[model samples]
Structures are given as structure tokens and as C-alpha cells.
Target: MEHRFDLLGSGWVSVECDPKSYRLSSGNQKRALAIRQLIDSAYNPIDWQLDFKSGYRWRADRLSGTLRYGHEPAVDVKVPWELARLHHLSWLAQSGDEKSIREFRNQVLDFAAANPPGYGVNWLCTMDVAIRAANIIIAYDLFISQGIEFDEAFLGEFHALIVAHGKHIMANLEWHDVHRANHYLADIVGLLFVAAYLPCTDESNAWLIFSVEQMINEVERQFTPDGANFEASTSYHRLSAEMVVYGTALVLGLPKDKKAILGGKNSFPDWYFERLERMAEFCVHVTKPNGRVAQIGDNDSGRFFKICPSFDEAGGTFKEQHLDHRSTVAAINGLFEREDFEEFSGPDVALDTTVVSALAGGQKITSYLKPGDNPGAMGVQITGGVDSGLSVLAQTFIEPVDATVLNGLTVFSYPDFGLFIWRSSRFFMSVRCGPVGQNGNGGHAHNDQLAIELNIDGEDWIADPGTYLYTPAPNDRNAYRSVHAHAAPKIGDKEPSRLDFGLFRLENNVDARCLCFSPDGFEGRHAGYGVPLHRHIEIQDGKIRITDLISGTKSSKVIPRIVKDGTSLRKLWSLDLRFSPGYGIRD
Candidate 1:
């Protein structure tokens, strides 16, 4: 069996030797130690102890061994085990201890033996399988580089396990109709990685061809022309971008004729790299001064890997870490040699040579021309409706504005995605004024049409209520995606977009646009509640004014809502309510 060792480098540098070399963040050593203790006590570390499967339809305590893995109906056991991340293995690999490495090897072998080809919670989701495959491949490379020797039999079993995973993923591709997000992207990336590096055979060659086509199509289908993800979720955007990065690297590392044959007329590397640059720039633009991107849409805290410390370290899980935007920026910068992206660079910015080495295959990365600049900023100012104390920003301006005035303020408008950002020294705000989401009911889009998020005094004052969970508790899922959860007005209890299908699906897109933009303020309108609702936003003198006007109707009233944390619910005209600060969290 001939392996394509030429794709990825011969071996990856161990994390112990160069801690900051890879984009992956340091593992939770504490969790690893606890697992070690459990293993020493003859307890299987793979057993799901914590009940992370609460609100889902079928719940069980896998730790107590009450629920059989493959026998359980409609239960997703991935959450409980968290095996997809392979953080435990990462911790052990980082430890560099002989015993820990041995334990890691044994644990993996034990899992393969117990799970077999198609059994248990591990094989439930093909996306999870793909993730596990990629991590294992990386781990194997890392271990071999560290002088950890595996007998031929053990190596054969591991290789067979990976092939099995590749087959499973290829057999059951997770392509949601017109709603392909990170999961599907991950599936393709994992397949490509296995096909590229694993021992080359007829099966591997077939998988590679199929994955290349699908990956290219998915990139165009999922990413907006303006560079934003069609799903309209910042978290998913990062995840999908990472998939593109990894997939592109593998494809680029292929032999010249092989790449040409795989990617016919158009060059796959050039196509993917173009989008990669756009995706990276989009991340940079949306990122806040604090190095965190706006949580504008659904955030399940999913990632290809934990490449940074958990953002909510005190109470959140390892998966809940902020997407490693800095590492992504660094990777893009290093590969493309674009210095303009420096403005978005953070202190944590460090290039991960793993990706570079994989792409280069022992060759030096050649310098490329830097891409053009991203959209320049335009200033904004608020003008009207100060006395009403209503959070009213205008949407439709009746008067024509001057061109010079429009150019003064720093404003970014992604017309394709229907997102607008206006920033000044003291205040930064983003408005959602566009289609509900991509084609065929955007699975990741929230009903936040005409909704606005405000960061005043450098603090997020008004925000979009993030997606709490998917397919877990129906009520919570619906509530988080509802208009009530956003900073948008509800017209007679009608949602801008209807939840027509499952947890993530939406119907009836609200067409919204920025009708007028100037240094003074922004005006936009949306048609979702059988009437055009206009919103006008103005920023001036450390104060914001928002005005809402309903057109083509008078009897139907519009109640503008704002979501904030630690606020009183005192009623003057209507009932006041508190809102959730984040997913699975309420104040």
C-alpha cells in the first residue's frame, strides 16, 4: 500500500517542542488528569459521565450505562462523550510523558475495538466521524514524529479505522438542501484529508475526486459574494473558513498533473484561496476591538478544534471558546503575505506552521501579491426623535443626501448579506437589513430583520439573542430565534420569518435594505408583517436615537423591543421583560 506522505509533511512538530507553533490552543490538562485518574481506577474514560444531553428528545445517562449506544432511538450521544473534539488525546500528546502517550494509544485502540466499524454513539453522526478522523490523523502524525512506535498490526487497525470512517462519511454526506453549513463543509474536508494523506488506493482516489467537486460547489453555494457566510452566523463562518483552508492546503499539495486532472479548467487552489481571503477579511471586519466577533446569529460553540482559550472560561465548556479568529488571520497573512490585514491583528496572533508545512510539502511558501483593501469606513450621526426616549433609528429618508456627507463617516454595507456596520470612536453598531437568509430556508438564520445591535461606551448595550440550542428543546430553540429575542419590533405578535420546519429552518424571508445612508444616520425598511416597517438610527453626542415608522397601515401597532441584561421589567404602556444574555442563558 502506497501512502501519500508527500501531501502533509513527514511529521508534525510536537506541541511540547513548540507550544505556539500550531493554531490549536493548549489542552485542558486538568480534564486530562481527571480522565487519567478515572482510567487508573479501571473506569472507561470514554463513558459519558456528565449529562450534556438534557433538552434533546431522548435523554439518558451514558455514564450509568443505562442507555445502550446503538440501541437508543433518536438520541445523539456525541454531546455526552464529546469524542469528536479529541481534546483528551490532545492533552495527552501535549504532556510528552511516556505513560500518557501509552495511555493515549491504549485508549484509542480500546475505542476502535469496542466501537467496531459501525456501532455505538461514536458512529451516530458522520460529521462527528469526519471530525474524529481528522483529529486522529493529526494525532497519528504527531505521535509518530515524537518517536512513539506502533507495531504493524496496531498501525493496520488504526489505518483500517480511518478508512472505515472515510467510507462512512462518503456514503452519508450531510448536505442540507440549500442550507449546507459547517457540518457539510467539515464532511468534505475530512474526506479530502483522509484521501490525500492516507495510503493511496482506488478507493482513496475515488473519494478524492468526489470530495474535490463537492468542496468547490459548497464554497460557492455557502459563501456570499460579499465574503460573509450565507448562513449569516459569525461562528459558522469561521468554522467553514477553516474547512476551506484545510481542504485547499491538501488539494494544493497534490502533484501538478493530479491537481490539474482533479480540478479541470479552473484552478482549485486559486478559486479556494480567493474565497479564503474574503472570508478572512470578513472575519477581520466583524471582529470587535476586544478581538471578539459579534455573536450576530446562531452559536452552538462548535469548532474544528479548540485553537484558543475558552472565552467563557469560568463557566463555559472547552467548546465554548471564541472562534480562533486571530489564528485564522495569521494563517491567511502568512500564506498570502498580505500586510493590510495587520489592523485586525491581535496580540495572540501567531502563525501555525502545520498548515503551511502541509501546503508546501517541504517547499517554502512563495510570496503572493496582497489583495485589494476591504471596504473603507464611513461615519454616521443620529439626528431626530430625542424626546420620545424610544430606541428609534430611521430607515426611509425622504430627502436626498449629499455624496460628500456619505463619504465622511466609516460605514460598511454588505448588500449581499444585508448587513451594515457604522462605527465611531465611542459607538459601534450593526444593523440587519436584508433577506432572512440564503436560499431554501436558511437553517442558521434568525428572525432578526431590521434588528440592530449596539455597542455604546464600548459595551454591548443592545444585542441579538443568540441561538441557544438546535433540536434539543423546541420551545427554547424557537424562542431564541424569534423576533422577541432580538432588538426588533414585533408587529401584532407576527414574526418576521416563520419557523416552518425543524429547529433551524425558517420561511418567509423579510426583504430589507438600507434606503438611505449618510454621516447623519442610517435609514432602512423591511416588509415582513404585511407592512413595511421603517427604522431610522442616529448616533450623536454619546446618545443614540431610533425611530420606527410603519407604512401602509395604522391600526396594526408596532412595539419596538430592546434586549439588555440586568434591566428592570416595569411596565408603562406594555409588559416589560428580561432577556437572555447568551445561548442556554437567561437573565
Candidate 2:
């Protein structure tokens, strides 16, 4: 099918922000520029140095450089540049010459159509999700503008591939189901757009729609309400919220004639808007002075915020409009107007929705180290709410860091070797001590406890971290998981002393404290001595609080507010931890 292009000048013009509503403060401008610069400087995965020893043959120097720069195409080169370039396209689409637009559309479409299998998996490191989506966006825009005949055959072929390999997509790519970041959400939206536009009969289209709806429902159910996130970072929250917006729009955009089949509204369910707002607000909660989000979970360090476009061409336009409006989501119950978005946005809070953002945010957050008496494996849950909150199930320290690590990994790890551990998203602050001591038994295989986001601004943080990189070799996989990334101890022995394992589960002013009653007496051979009460308390705000009343400890007055600046709470409680000389603790 031949593609045509429509060069509409009005729509292509740059968006204008309402000066009063979308004011760009000096600080906000600086933060935005910094974030842009960081993305510009770090948009090369070649700097990451990923190990390819197992598969591709290579010279030593090349291998060394790849290692240093994460030479892997999927993680390093492709994605970074792709994301950066795609964002540039979004920028250009608003102001480029007709010749540039035509050339850009042709090149991007050709590259996308000619990609390698697995949707260009081999070229992926060089092509981040942003790039892939951007390519789709460009193609879609070209098709829409030129009024090209929809390629029924290509759609059929794509659908046929899905029909043939639906199970593989389900099983192998299950993580996408749980992924709450922008990239995964964008993929989901793209798939939905394809499904919606495909010309198949009802019989063939039914299953696909069901599957798509299931994914959408999961996104709504898991990521909002609890105001919790796997990584507990700002950037990722932005990504997830954008995904929600994209998904909602795709659903709402279904031809009006087909609207009856869906929930039958011009927009998404009211609750979806609520959850999106909460997720957006939750990220705002963690926003800092700089426009760049505070990296909280396992935020990618090799590359930064390379601008990537959406898969659906229309989506790209929407994103561009939003970006021009500073990409802000409105407050609760507010209509998603571009002007209103600026009122909610500030340079201090650019939404970040990647693993890298999570780790970086984790470092900047000061409250992680405080003592909270709540302890135990918080019940793992994933659900949605009415107030537009995402539930992220995360357990704060319930037992000592060591014990919590042992218990959490025991339940969530690979289960076969006990050697390979995995956790839901946001497994940060890891320290491997030659694979022994706290690092040996406590960390690894996965990060610490299996914490769920209870509420993003009052909803649930869904799922855990999606496994984007996994290989047998230690270093290859370890690149994504480590102590240095997490907020835990990196010093020789700064790991927390007391084995306090209490999670501070918060929902706005309300928080549920979990504490594990050591079912059996402490029986670790390292210390040789049974310890004292294994928990303490540090509360913040007027939210109701619960403390684990260990059998022998007397009732004590615990501090209600835990400060972020490292000021000790007033006589809440203290521990006298005794570690044998050589051993260490983990945060």
C-alpha cells in the first residue's frame, strides 16, 4: 500500500501555553533544561558497557568498551539515541518544513517496517521503547495525513502472528502485564490502537479485544489507588500516568459506532481519572527542586530522559501538546486540560517512570533510614480504588534488614536454586559482600522485602519491577541490581545494626504497620546470641499507627513524626545490636 502525507500547517504549529496557567518559573525552566541536557549527554548506551561474552564473539578492546558503556544494543545504544531522537521529532513535527516532514516520515516508516524479529530485539538497545513508539507514531501520522488506504493485509498478518503466538506473548512477556512505567503503557496503548483499528470480523477481533481489555483493566487496577509504586520514584509515576491517559484515550477514541461495546462514555471511567490523578499527585509528592525526578528504585544510570514518541501517531500529537504544556496531569476531579496541567506542574517535579528514576529518587529521599516499629511481611496485594489511587504493596522494615531479606527472598525468589532472587519493581540499596554475611543471606537473588505500593497518593503501586535484562552470567544481570543503587548501606559497616524489620505502610494520613512475630526463636548461627526486642517505632502525621508489641517488651511512647533531616525522634526506642566483629548489616 502506498502511503500519502498531508502537510497541515495549523495542526503542526507549536502549541501556545496560557501564560497565567502555564507559567514557567525560572527554577522550573532550569530544571527542565537540566533534565533535557542530562538526556542529551547520556543518550548513548555505548557508555553502559554490557557484557556479551556468552553470545557474540568480539575483540578484547571492543568488549572492554562495551562493558564500560553497556554496549548491548537493547540497553545502551539503540534506546538512548532512539528516545532522544524521537523527542526531537516531536519537537520538529511542531515546526519542521514540509520537506523535512516528508523525509522524516519516509525514513522512520521504512526503518520500522524493516526491523529485525522480536520487533527489532537485536537493535533494541540502540532503539529504546521511545524510538519504537516514535516510529509507529510517525508512520501513523503519515498514513492519517496522506489518507493512505489502510493495509488490511498487514493488519491481518500481524494479527495472525499474534494468534499463532498468543501464548508466547502471554507467558514470556508477562512482565509487561505488571509493568507500570510509561514505556510498557505506551506499548499497551499501541497494541490497543492496532486492535481497535484492525479490520477483522467480530469472531477474530473478540479475543484480541478481551486480551487488550484485560491488560487495560490490570493497568487500572494495579497502578492507582494506593498511591504506592514499586520504585517509589517520581519519573516512573509520570510514565505510568501517561500510560493511563494513553490507554483511556485509545479506549475512548474507538469509533463512536463501536462505543457501545466498551463502557460507553466519551472518556474513561471516572475512577480511572481519579487513579491517574492520584498517581500523578503521588509523583508530585516526591518531586524535588530540579525538574529531573528523584531516582528512587532501580533507575537506569547508563542513559537519561531521551525523548521518545508514542506508537500511535495521534498519541504523539497528544503527547507533544501535553509536553508543550509541560506534561502535567491535573489535580483530583479536574478535567485534563493542557492549561490546567501547568498549574499542577513545577520544575521540581518532572514525572519519571523508569527503573533508573527509582534508584536516583531512593538516594534523595531522607526518610528511608528512620526507625519504625512496624515489622513483618506486609500482606502482598494488587487492587484499585475509587479515589484514583494506585496500590503499590511495599513493606518497610518489619524485621531486621537481614531477617526481612531472608524471609522476602525465600518467598519471592526463583525458588529452584535459591541462588537467583527477584523482587517486584524498586529493589534498590543492595550490597553483596562476596556473596556472604548480610549480603550473602540477606540481599541478592532479589532486592529486599516484597513491598507493594499501597497507594500512589492513596492507591496501590502495582506489581514489581519488570525484568528487562536477565542473563545467566553474574555481571550481565547484576548491572541492573546492586547495593550502590539502593538506599541501603555502601560503607564498610553502615548497614543498620538492629535486625529491625518493620514496613511503614502509608495511605495519606492512614498507615498499616506490619510486624512478624518471630514464629520460632531467633536461630542464626552468626551472632551466637538471641537478641532483644527486634522492632521500634517512628510515626509521622496524625494517621493511626500500630506497633508490634513483642512478648517481653514494655509499653513505650513512640514518636509520631519521623523527620527527613535525620533528627532522632524523642525517646521512641533504641536498640543495642551486637554484631560479631567481621559481619555487617544492610539497610
Candidate 3:
């Protein structure tokens, strides 16, 4: 099933023009210098392909498909793709950093020349391909807006890169079954940006029509009724949300007629903005008072663009920063200027808000903003388009939730997301119970069916261990996602889900359910280990009381025990769970 785009071979780079531009601010000059300096940190120019941890280099001569994921000594394809994502280089060009700009240009030409179209591990996964191309487009568009110049030779080479990336995505789109995931969504977005930025041509226009329709349709599909991502992982929720928000803004910024396609007959419905707001609302609720989110599921620290700094003292590499979820809140706030979204908006996310403001048709954006002030206003209006089948199973309102769960604890339940949250001024807890993510493929869902992450008195107590790695080390991957990693009942060495399914999947044996959910407490059960295990959690007199109602007596050597909540404060200090919060982060 091959589709066609007019951009196939040489001379596809159309003449540059002042098509409506959403120019990103030239970020912090100091940080831009660091980014430019470290632009070459991830890849080895000698071979142009690399594995950071293992030092294994995939030669440019090899086809991406030839190098299998999780090969023996273990090579991560993400390392090279990290360099190719080109965010730092883009910023360098945007900042007018002459020295770094030269490096950026040279690197772009070298990488493109070394790894021709479909060669090397960098092009292996279409998801990465889409992300890489989108970033390159963003950089190029920004450079154009800033009046930065590039040599004719590099422009020719770069346009060829764009043509190749566009063709590769259409051919290898990750659309397979009834359930399409983030990867598919990203593919559409990449193509959308490419089509939007390219000079007016039938090929780019056709791509525009196809991608715009699909972006709206897929965003509706991938997000749950409660606004949680279908991937079942909170961090991944941020990644896919970014693709939708950023892509939507670019479409809104297009010239009137081109943008009319979104508001006319087909129209970009209101529900799209509503769900996006709720997705940001979900971010507010899941994040703890400590400012870090409860790593509810897989967090690869994935992003479409590094528009904002990771803000972590331990941050430098692409994978290091993920705990901060407020920037997403700020991005949403910037796009719609929704009053509810202002909760997480401040100095922390001023840059993020400014970036989104530019993309959403705001005026010339600056890198700074006064507190409580948004960048600029987008006069564009979104009218038309039907419901598009958007179901709001759980409603999220900006006002403080009035419902109480005994003793001032606020209860929030997103059944679609399979999470029950109870929070008070001094105590907060989240219980995981629901369908395996990715439509039960459980690609990003862990085996912690009855798992709970608790923070009492603003100190991390029990936690859901985060995803450390994928593909490269199978055992660690299984271990991190194992039921044993969380404070949930497990029967003597019996697993609730099979880890052997695949690196990215989990087959849930446990039909975990919440039988009783009320202000009193949360009572849930699961049949993951061949026996029904019940967990009753209630707060009493400010301390937590967790009871396991396992039928144990006469013939009962087999009984589910309540996993303890207290771990060493030392370990808790290590990472809120004695594990890295994201992939490639140190243990």
C-alpha cells in the first residue's frame, strides 16, 4: 500500500518564500551555546552511527533494517537519532551563533551524506524518522524567519533529506491494527509539518490535506475520554500530546485559505481543544505537590522538540529530564489561553508558553514573559466540524474538585486511564487498576495491576519504579515492568503478566478491577496470580492503613500479603523509587 508525494528526487527543494511563519525565539544565548557545543556529543562522526553506552557503531553501509534492535552486545538506535533530532543545531542557527552555526550546517550535511535516505540505524524506526524530519523542518523554518543563510550545496543536500524523509514515512507508516498508537500519530505530524512549511506545490498540498485530516482524526482516537493517553503511560501522554498541540498550532498559523480547511466544511472541532485542555488537566492532577509526577507508567523522556530545557540539575542528555510536566501545561495554556491552564503557568514555563504562542499565531514571540501574562493572542477562530465521536467519559473542570474522600482527601478517578487518585494537603496516593495500555497489547503498561504510588507529607513513600531501558537489555526491561517492582500483592513467584511477550508489550493475566470506589477509600482486586487478591486502602487519623483481604486459614499456605510502603529514605532520595526516572538515566 504505497502512497505518492511529488517530492521524490533531486531539485525538490522549492524556492524559499515568506509563507506564514511561526518563528521560534532564539532561546537563552548561554544554553544555546552549550547545546551547540554538545551537538556532536551523541554521535561518532567517524562512522556517523553510534551506540553511546556500548560504543558500538553501525556502519553507514548497512541498511537500517539489517541492524536488529537489542543485538547481543546491545546497541540503542536512539543514540544516533538523538543527534539527528537536530534541536540544538536549530537553536544554534536561530541564535545567530556563527561558530556553532557552521558546526550545525556541517553536521547536517555530513549526517545526510553519511546516512543516505534509508541507511543506518537512525532511519530504522519510522517514529524517529518522523521526529527527526519535523525538527529539521522547524529549524530550517526558524532560520528562514531569522534571515539566516545557508550555502547552496547544503540547501540542495538538505532538501533531498526532506524528500527522502517524506517518502519514507508514507511507505513505512506504523498503522497496522484497529488500535493505532503514538508512533502512527507522530508519522502524520511529521508529514504535516513538512507539507505545511514547503513551498506551494501539488505534492506538499496533497500531503497537507491528508495530514491535517488525519491529525484531527488520530488525536481524537489516541486520547482517552478522560484525556489520558491510550498508551497507559503518563510520560508518553506528554510526548503524543506535544505532537498534536504543535501540529495543530502550525495548521492554525497557515494562510487564510489553507487554514480554512481546518475551519470550513471538515472543520477542526471544539472537542479537539477541550480534550487537549483535559490532557493538560490530567498533568496537573497526576503531578505531586513536590512538582514531580508519579511516574505512573513508561517514561522515555520523549519529545517532538526540546523547546524548553529539562530544568533538572541532573539534566544534560536527551533522556535525562522527564519529571517536569508543567511545561506541557504551559504549552496548552499558551495555545488556548484557557484560564484553567494558568494553574501550572509561571516563570518555569514562560519560555514554553512563548514558544506555543508563536506556533498558535501569536505575534512576534520573545523568550521572556511577565508572570501570569501570556505571549500574544491568536485571532484565529475554530468553528465547524462535527463531534468527531469525542467521548468525555470523565469530565475535567478547572475549578477545584468539591468531592471529598473522607478527612479532606480529594478523589479523582479516570476509569478509562485505570487510575484512582486521592489527595489531601498532607497526603497523596494513586492506585493503578484498569486495562493494559495500547488497547490491551500492554505495550507501555506494567504488571503493577494493584500498584499504588504514595506521597505522605510531601515525601516520597511507595513508588512505581520507572522504565529504565527498552530493547537493549531484555532482563532489565522485564524487571522494571515486573509486578515485583511496585507495592502490590504478588503470589509466591507467580507473575500477573507474562514479560516474555515482547520488549514493548505485556499480556495482562490479571483482570484488575475496582469493585468499591468511594469517599471511604479504594477497594480493588485482581486475578493475576491464579487467585483473586483483594487490596483495601483507607486513610485513618492522618496515617495510611492498607489491608489485604486474602482468604487465609486452614488450608491456606497461599495468601496474598500486603506489600510494605516504607523503603529507605536513602533509596527514596535516590530517585523517589530507587530507580532512574527515565531511560538511559543512571541506576
Candidate 4:
């Protein structure tokens, strides 16, 4: 049987080292130790305990039910690949036992044998399935090397399943959407693994080659030019990079046309590396005073894998770079005793990393937006709403595409329904929508259209804690969308009346000056592409202040005046953003 080692990715490396002899060597020892330590520390002894505890009794019963009746095979019933890999691998690794491994081997073989190939979710969980399967393959390979019996039938079945799934994704998935970036990596790598181990028949070989080419093209097009913004969360971006780089590396390792894969030496721009640096920077900056990024979008659970080596070590190899890559690289290198490593840098993250709250006595609460959309979205918390700090909107806008919505905007939410999405509109009007729901449709249905923060010096308070956990459960959505999560008082109506804030950019296209308001200091500038114009305003006690500053080609400024009854919070609450005529492109 001819095995093709060319199932992995091949790319430019500034260093020369024997891939075969590579192990956790040199300064890498620290990284290896860190990896092991993380796993060990997180692996509670109770996790390995076979007996059920009082707290997990429900979960234990549910698992028992699944073991007994869940496999009846309803067409709608889906068993995630990750769960299977976890079960089989955990059973094997935890006990060093062959019983579970052997049983799982048989089960995988039997299922593959019975089911037709390439029949699964084409859109949903595509990358997820691939990663779980690859992890399982890795576990199986490890076990077999240890003299644990390997069943040819099982191995063949697993390989065939991979090929089928690969073909399924190639034929169906929309490769254009940048949101599918991570999924593309997982699928590509999974296919490469299958090609390496399975029989390289004409059909399988062709499929493998085609999948690799398509994936490379997708990465180049989606990540390089437009760049993956990963506005969702820092952790998700890391996860995204992991799936892609890991899979790409596996494929590159396979014997193939390296030049074609890498688009020739110096053909691609260095933006990917730049993006990685930016992402790493954001991770370093946005993490709470502690080291946690807000868990907003699709973040789940995982420790950062410092031991996992990628093209990043060479610095600028790939086309889609994350911001924090530089810092993470530095931290990882420092772990391994590399002199080139950077010093640890970042604010102290809050311990809760979930939600924080404060009370004064008045009706003032403040919740800062979470860092990332997916996982980082969860990191948002509130503190001293009516009590501690005056209501403040300290925002550092990072321009990129949100991971979930795949737009150049960041979203904020009050768990279930109270939500907000903001984007820098180069056009005359600033565009925004709010207080939405999390029902897998267009962004969300949050009723809070144009929400702004205000700090009031008072004795009474109410605050909104950003989020605790995720949804379906009553409080799950509340983590991102409860009224108590923000400093603003909930209107009598369950929903706010008008929710969209529009801002038309003025034509002058110049940086607007900051105007400070007393009683409460405030400064905000409209920052980004198109026409550069902004309105900085402030409020304290019963006093209201407004500042109009817009930098444009014509250099103009409108006199500051209250447009509505400043004393009435309701009428004055509206965000009025208008642009001088001819401040934008002619329609």
C-alpha cells in the first residue's frame, strides 16, 4: 500500500530542522510542561471518578439514558463527533484500559459500516464534526502505537467516513462567507489525514487533491484580501486559527506541490501576519483587568495551547493574521525560555470573568460592551452602576468583521432581548440597531436601538450584569440582555419605542475635536473611514451638555445647542446625527 505523506500543508519556514526528530526540545520544555499542567490542573480527580456525585447525578442519569435508549437512531437525532471522541479517548487515556477503546472501535466500525457516507449537516457543525473526528483519529493512532489492538475494519470505516464527509463539504458548503473560515480549516485537515492513512485509490486521491486546492483558494480569498476580523471573540479567533493551521499543516506535510499551496515565494502580502498581531494585541488589551476576554459570541471552553506550534513562529507565513498572535507568541516563547520572547503584558482580568455588579441607590447602571462577539462576548460584566464609577463609555473600536454576523461591527447585548450593534458608517448617517434576540436569524431583535451610557451622581442604584452563561434557560439569555445588566432604566414598555440610530457623515472628512462637558467629563470622536465627523456630548445631575465637532473637506462646525427639552431624559435621550449637505458621495 502506497501512503502519501503529502497530506499536510507545506509553507515557507526561515528555520531548518528535521521534522522527524522533532520533539518537545530546547526551550520548548516549558511549553510542554505548561500544556501538561493546564490539562492536569483542569482535569479534576472527580472527573476521572467513575461513580456519580450528587451534583452530577442528573448528568449521570442522562448519560445512562443515552447509553440505553439514545441510540435507537431517529433521523433527527444527532450524535456530535466531539462527544464520541471525548468518550472513546477519555476512556482509553484515563484508565489505560483497552476495554472501552476496543468497544468504541467496534462501535465506530459498526456505525460506519451501516451508514452511507457523506450524509450529514452541510452547513451546521461542519468544522466541529471534522475536528472531533480528527481528535478521535489521533487518539486511535496513539493507542495503536502502544500495542492496543487495531482493527482493520474499524480503521477502514473511520477513514471512509472522513473521505465521505470531506466530499460532502466540498460539494455543498458555501466557501465564500468569511464566517466559515475556521470550518474550512477543520475540513481541509480532516481530509488530509484521511488521505494520508487510507487507501489512495483514484477517487480518494482526486477528492483529497481537490479539497486541498479549494481550501487554499478559500483561505487566500477570504482571509487575505478582506481579512478575517474575528469580531466575535479573541478565544474563538484562537480556536479558528488552531483548526485552520493544524489542518493546513497536516495537508502541507503530505507530498504535494508546495509552491502551488503557498502561491509561490513572496506572492501573497503580509497582511495575515499583521492581522494576527492585531488580534493578539486585542487579546492583550481587551481582556479584563484579568486575562479573560468577554465571552460574547460562540465561545465555549478551552485552554490556550501554547505547545501547539504553527507557521506563526517564522512570523509572517500565512495570509490571515490575528492581532494577539505576537503577544501569545511572546508568552509562549517566554514559557519555552526563548530570549526573543516578549515580556508578559495585559491588564488584570476580573476574577468572575462572567458578570459584575454595583449598587448606589439611584436608577443608574452601566455595562461595558464585551470584547469579542462569540466567546469574548461572555466576558462582559458590570460594576458600580449607580455606585462605583460614573457611567462611562470607554470604547476602543477595532475595525473588522464580526465572527458570527460577519460584518464590520461589534454587538452588545443584555442577554435575552436587550441588545446593541454599532458600526462606523462612512455615509452621512451612523447606522445602529438594538436590544435584539438570539434566535439564529439576522443578528438579533434587541429593542434598545440607540443606547448610550450616562454616569449620574446619586444615592440609589440599579445595575445590569452583562452575562452569566448562555441561553434557552431563563437567565441564560439574561447574561447578555437583561434590563438589570445596564445602567439605563427600563422603559414602561417591555420594548423601547424607537431603536435605530442613523448618522449621516458630513463631506469635509476631517478629524473632529473633542469637547469636554463639566459636572461630568465626556469626550467621543467619530473614528473610521469615509467622512470623519463626530458629536461628543456629556450629562451630569440635571445639567446637559453637547459638543459638535466634525472635520471635513470644507472645514465646518455647527453651533452647539440643545435640540430638545434637555431636562426631560426621554426626549433628550434621542441621538441626533445629521450631516451637512454634500458631505458624502452623490447618489
Output the number of the lDDT-best candidate: 3
What TM-score fits each model? Answer: 0.75, 0.43, 0.79, 0.43
lDDT tens digits by residue: candidate 2, 542-572 = 1212222222334455343332111121112
What is the alpha-carbon lDDT of model 2 when measured against the actual structure?
0.30
For residues 528-553, could you state the per-residue lDDT of candidate 1 as single tens digits?
A: 77666777776553334566777654
* Model 2 TM-score, all chains together: 0.43
Best by TM-score: 3
| Candidate 3 clashing pairs, residues 3+ apart or interchain | none
Q: How would you encode candidate 3's per-residue C-alpha lDDT over 115-190 as one tens digit per residue?
A: 5666667788888889988888877766676777887756766787788888888888989677679999999999
- What TM-score does structure 4 among the candidates reach? 0.43
lDDT values for all models: 0.58, 0.30, 0.66, 0.32
Which candidate, 2 or 4, has the higher lDDT?
A: 4
Q: Which stretches of candidate 1 lie over 4 Å from their true place?
A: 1-43, 48-78, 145-148, 255-266, 269-271, 309-320, 340-409, 424-426, 540-542, 554-587
- Candidate 3 global lDDT: 0.66
